[model samples]
Target: MLPTVILPGYLESADVYLPLQQALTALGTPTTTVPLRKRDWLPTLGGRSMIPILRQLDRTVSAALVDNQAAQINLIGHSAGGWISRIYLGDIPYTIHGDVTEAEQLWNAKAKVANLITLGTPHISGERWTKKNLDFVNDNYPGAKHPEVRYVCVAGKSIYGEKKLGQWLAYSSYQQTCGEGNTWGDGITAIKAAHLTGAINIEIEGVKHSPRTPGIWYGSPAVLPQWTGYLS
Candidate 1:
């Protein structure tokens, strides 16, 4: 089995995914997470650039390859990490901030990835703050762009976005993510926004977006079985 690397979401530290790493290990799949702390995301706070995060991801991938003695590995990116993983897998130069030099063009990771599983990732976004990065990802590497790597997009259907007070947050998040608010989502990303056109899309009925949220999430022990089957 190919070793797996878990890329946590924006502002999330690697420690938050320990439960998930342990679960995957118990299933016989060697797993590791990019050693990222919340402080590491501070530099990219204003949508400036994700180059720093990508660099950490590259190092972790390299280490996973060497340590596991595997030619390729599986990547499981949650939330924003998912789209960032898309950028990592592409050959196109990511030029959002216009700071990526030729020497920094080492993020073309498709050759080292066997499968990619995204959890409640907003593949599309309408918010102005995130437009530049999202645009670059969509324009350069569209849905399921790489045929060699399997793409499995998972969305949770625990919350229905509504204008009411109880669901207003979900409603607003869905609107910002996919330009639609009155839809089903995982409390942060709408199902439509989380899915890719040519990927194997899945929707879990009672899951939330993150582990911190009430109820089961993508990384939850119960939910892992729902999508981990696609890892190999």
Candidate 2:
């Protein structure tokens, strides 16, 4: 069973998380998507403002889901979604410089991260790297206070490039931003990258995207069995 929550990436709709949410729920686990409001700071800071945003998000999600008792929760995120997930699961106490108890800190993971699953995210000292981002996904975050939760990264197999009408215009910009090889859901992020960052990665291949596809497709049940072990 899963006691997890899903978070979406930038310019994404809550719809992106619906499939996985339903899948977990079908497995008889509670799941929900954390709704994010449009913020003025998002464009300027990107997800680098993740610490504060997660603190605020923790308040809303914990309130709505746990009634103040959200102890063990799996956090599944993609892209910028994964960035926020790392900040939420991490234990540095909101980078805002506060003295809050670890248990009382944002996302309140004094217990431990039940699971941290990321999809198509860059978790190491990559091209546009920053120390803050480096610490969690990069340094594996000290003060975990528990066994670092199981980490599963599902990356794309095929690289998306500016070859045709579809891939070039849409995906080229995203890859260029990170100095990453052009990719969609099929590009494999090096496992060495995960080792350097201290997270277990589950590499999946051949499920490319077209920017036309939204979140999980209704047909993904066929692929679900393949990833079930990773989910476990």
Candidate 3:
């Protein structure tokens, strides 16, 4: 059986992905969501600790795929999970200020995989929170291409706020959120951003950061239709 790997963001876990996973399972897809151990502040400090975050995802994705004998891995991410997918395929480097000597980008380009589904992910040059992540995607992945790895992005339109996905105050000076008229655009960009980057884009209508039909983090039913299209 093929593998459909769904990843949860910071505090998000099997519970958050349960609804989405069950929905996919109905389609005859063997779905699995790997819940990273709950971290109190790692996500809130993504900027300073992004390297560690990316590393954990890399190891997890790699091991899960191999152990399950998954012939192909279909990737799906929400918020921080979306950011993780971007890091995995696009070799864009995010310099943790001057902290590390060598700049680290998301994903080991060599990791074999198929398809990337990004939900409510921010990847534009100038969104409310692009400075930290965009630094790499913009600089390194401009004309970049990942063979055998197709990508689909689905952004939200609701009024919501999330730690890894939002631009807000944090325990450390690293995290950014969608606070104070930050308007709708959280740290991640919406639909237009992905299209501009040349991805196989699937724009979902009637969804927002949060407070809309689907409830931001866990994801909204309005956006699930888009996910079904991609995850399938």
Candidate 4:
């Protein structure tokens, strides 16, 4: 089996995903995560560009390929990282700091991908900063449309809406992400947006966005049975 490369989300560091990485590694598939720090977002968020993030991901991909000595590897992206992986797959075009001269091709990265899995990734979003980029990804490469790659989208079903006191925070986050409050989600990404049309979509009953709190997440040992089947 090929090794798996894990990518972090927006403003996220690779350390937070250690639980999931350790879990996957223990399951027979060696895994490596992008060493992303908060500063990695500085060039993108501050400059209104995505080049920095994409380039960093590309480097991580290269490293994974070298370390595993395999022609292809699997990708497990969480949240924004999932959609960004789409951009890396080369279906859409992107520029750095709005300069067309800085355009890049992700074909090299695409050549190294085997399976791509997304955990609580918002396939659609309402925020302007992400809407344009996500729209491009969804429009060009919706779901598991790529013939060479198997796409799997995972969603959580722990929070329903803002009605209950316990759901207020999730509700607010869901509304901001999916532009709707009265829906199901994993406290941050709505289930509706987390699923894709052609990909293998799955929903977990008690998992949250990440393993950040009182319970296990999509990457935990308890939830591994839910989506790990697609790792190959």
lDDT winner: 1
**Can you list the residue pairs that collide in candidate 2?**
156-185, 156-186, 156-187, 157-186, 157-187, 158-186, 160-183, 162-168
lDDT on C-alpha atoms for all candidate structures: 0.92, 0.52, 0.54, 0.81
State residue 71's C-alpha deviation in candidate 2, in Å. 4.2
Poorest stretch of ten by lDDT in candidate 2 = 187-196
Native-structure RMSD, model 2: 4.9
Task: At residue 64, give the lDDT of candidate 3.
Answer: 58
Query: What does the lDDT read for residue 219 in candidate 4?
Result: 81
- Give the distance in Å from residue 15's predicted Cα in candidate 3 to where it truly belongs: 2.6
lDDT of 1 by residue, 1-232 (tens): 8899999999999998999998998898899999999999998887778998999999999999999889999999999999999999999887768777757875789999999999999999998878888899998889999999999999999999999988999999999999989999999999999999999999999999997777899988888889999978
Among all windows of ten consecutive residues in candidate 3, which has the lowest summed lDDT? 170-179
After superposition, candidate 1 runs with Cα above 4 Å error:
none
What value of lDDT does candidate 2 attain over all alpha carbons? Answer: 0.52
Q: lDDT by residue for model 2 over 55-92, one digit each (tens)?
A: 55575456534642645666666555665666666555
> Which residue pairs of candidate 4 clash?
none
Tens digits of per-residue lDDT for model 3, 1-232: 3567776654554565677787677776667776565663355353444555556666666675777776567777665666556666664444545543444444554245677777665554333444566556555664225656767766644332334543342211122332223334322343444342566766554464322223443254445655666553
Looking at model 4, report the run of 10 residues with the lowest lDDT sum: 99-108
On lDDT, the stronger of 1 and 4 is 1
- TM-scores for all candidates: the values are 0.98, 0.68, 0.67, 0.91
Ranking by TM-score: 1, 4, 2, 3
